[model samples]
Target chain A: MEQNLQTNEEIEMQLWEYIDGSCPINDMQRISILIERNTLWKQKYDELSALHTSFSTNVELEQPSMRFTANVMDAVAATHVAPATKKYINKSIIRGIAAVFFVMLTAIFGYALFSVHPTTGTTSMLPKLDTSKFNLSHVINSETIMIIVAINIVIGLVFLDSILRRKKEQQAVKP
Target chain B: MELDDTAVIQMVLQGQQAAYATLVTRYQQYVFTLVMRYVNNREQAEELAQDVFVKAYRYLADFKGNSKFSTWLYTIVNSTCLSHLRKRKDETILLEEEKMVSISDSNQAERPSDKMEQRTQKQMLENALKHLPESEAQALTLFYQGEQSVEEIGVIMGMTTSNVKVKLFRARQKMKDILQSRFSRELNL
Candidate 1:
């Protein structure tokens, strides 16, 4: 009788866990004792079990709408708009052109430094005395470097003008 | 051919943006229903569901494959629901009180008829669930959803397995009393 009472109390305490099939093995054995000993409790448990089963099987499933997928895709597209193609082209193409110009200017300076020599001091006798200020060593060493730098400055100004013009055109065209 | 969740996640991490759409399509309904259980409003549920997907996309890189993808997704859903509840502090209490009052009023004025009794019972159960403590309501719903093991639920809710068992017991009793009383009261038994 005492054992039966203990089983009944255990069953009441762990009834939901038993119904869920989540009761541990030891608890299961104990609850099974109560089930066998008391037919009323077993009947009540079975009815409740069936009720839960009925609820699960009969629960309504909700589908958003036929347009749900399309709506989501539309929202995604609307949010992350693709920037204009001309903007991309202006960015990469202009930067590439500028980079090429700078590299070419550097190469010209290098050639002047290593490959060209200054005219001899035989020309120093002329009245064009700019040559008086320039020695062959200094002229040969510095002329190419200075000319290459000047070319780079001019190229930089030209590149800046083109970039500004392109940006202005883009802004102007956007109505 | 269909790829598994792990494969889809890997593809997404490799910068395959389209793979994300597949993940969303597969789990959107499940995620939406889970959100609906919390917010209980269809439109708000939809918005929260979309927000959850966007968040999952953003944090897909951090999903380390330690758990199933669904578990990770559920963690995100649970957090999103909790955050929403926190933001609208009185909204939950108001919904519960509304449900309780409606149930009480319907009980007093209306005769218990046979034809719509099942519908009334279901409504009563839902109302009772709305009136449950937030933790108990969530625990019971997650249990019935059948997506996770008791251990997994305990992990999700940061409760002990025994504590989850006890809470579920209370929730079921509450449901049982509500359902039984609805029938008995209607028939004047």
Candidate 2:
């Protein structure tokens, strides 16, 4: 697509995609033409091309210490290679967890169903249930749910803030 | 002859432990460099990178070679670094862009006019990458140096392919912005 980008950011974005060679063949042709014809486009493309070339040619990978491989090998020797997670992860434990969850779900359904109170008079062949006796209004009314939802929203916002903001001072403390 | 990763892995699996070192030697720089993106200190990054290799070795049996070895290795690196950062979440690394100060707020403009111009293109690009968010920097590095496709980067970084593209775009802009502002005289921009 011929992107008539307005802002510098948008223009750079298109140039980056073009330099990365990810754009379609037609878009690449159009971008090539624009780079050749348009002064602004040429400047942007040249700068971006330099950046792309530096990434490939000029940038050097950070090398580890000479003993890095040896240290890793030493650790590997100390511990078994391909340590199967199966050794530590117990299938029985997983089955136990599943069973617990199953029991909990069954209890919840049982409580929901068995909480029904039989009516004094039968409406039909089956006895009528006084469902009103089980008032969910006290348990899950709009106000309570809204409060829970608000609290959740507040928690989510706090978490997002924490992720976005990094406190530089305390970063040295190792984990 | 240098064996491919898959062949080396197969040899290692078949009781040829020495062959595993070849894989480590090949990828040590890459793993170390990527780890340094999250943890800047050489000592800490080296430790983490070493642990990543060990962990990869431990889980070597599970690497069925369905994906490229580099992709699998990078996936491990991402998880390892992320988990390490999470462990010390109370004191995790800072996002340079999210700092309280911006380039304008800082004394970048006050430096000698030739200071930025004196820097090599490599050094300028390195500084720019340092200022980018970790994931964006990683996306750029993996794309150019790691020989990873956008889809592979997405898989490694737990982002969508489009999200990887967006990150790369942002990274390019940020790099250009940084360079243009810092070394305006050197670059014709």
Q: Report how far off residue A172 is in candidate 1 (Å).
A: 64
Provide the overall lDDT of each model, using Cα atoms, as 2-decimal numbers.
Answer: 0.67, 0.78
Tell me the tens digit of each residue's lDDT in model 2 across A101-129: 99999997776566655663333333466
**Candidate achieving the largest TM-score:** 2
* Model 1 per-residue lDDT tens digits across residues A20-53: 6766899888777877787866875776676577
Q: What stretches of model 1 exceed 4 Å from their correct place?
A: A1-10, A71-175, B95-111, B118-134, B183-189
Clashing pairs in 2: none
Encode model 2's per-residue lDDT on B1-189: one tens digit a residue. Answer: 778888999898888888889999999999998998888789999999989998888889887665788888999999998999889877866755554256555436445275676787777677767777777788888887788887778768877567878888777677767767776566454
Error of 1 at B10 (Å): 1.1
What TM-score is obtained by chain A of candidate 1?
A: 0.37
In angstroms, the error of model 2 at A141 is: 17
State the weakest 10-residue window (summed lDDT) of model 1 chain A: A120-129
CA lDDT, candidate 2, residue B56: 89
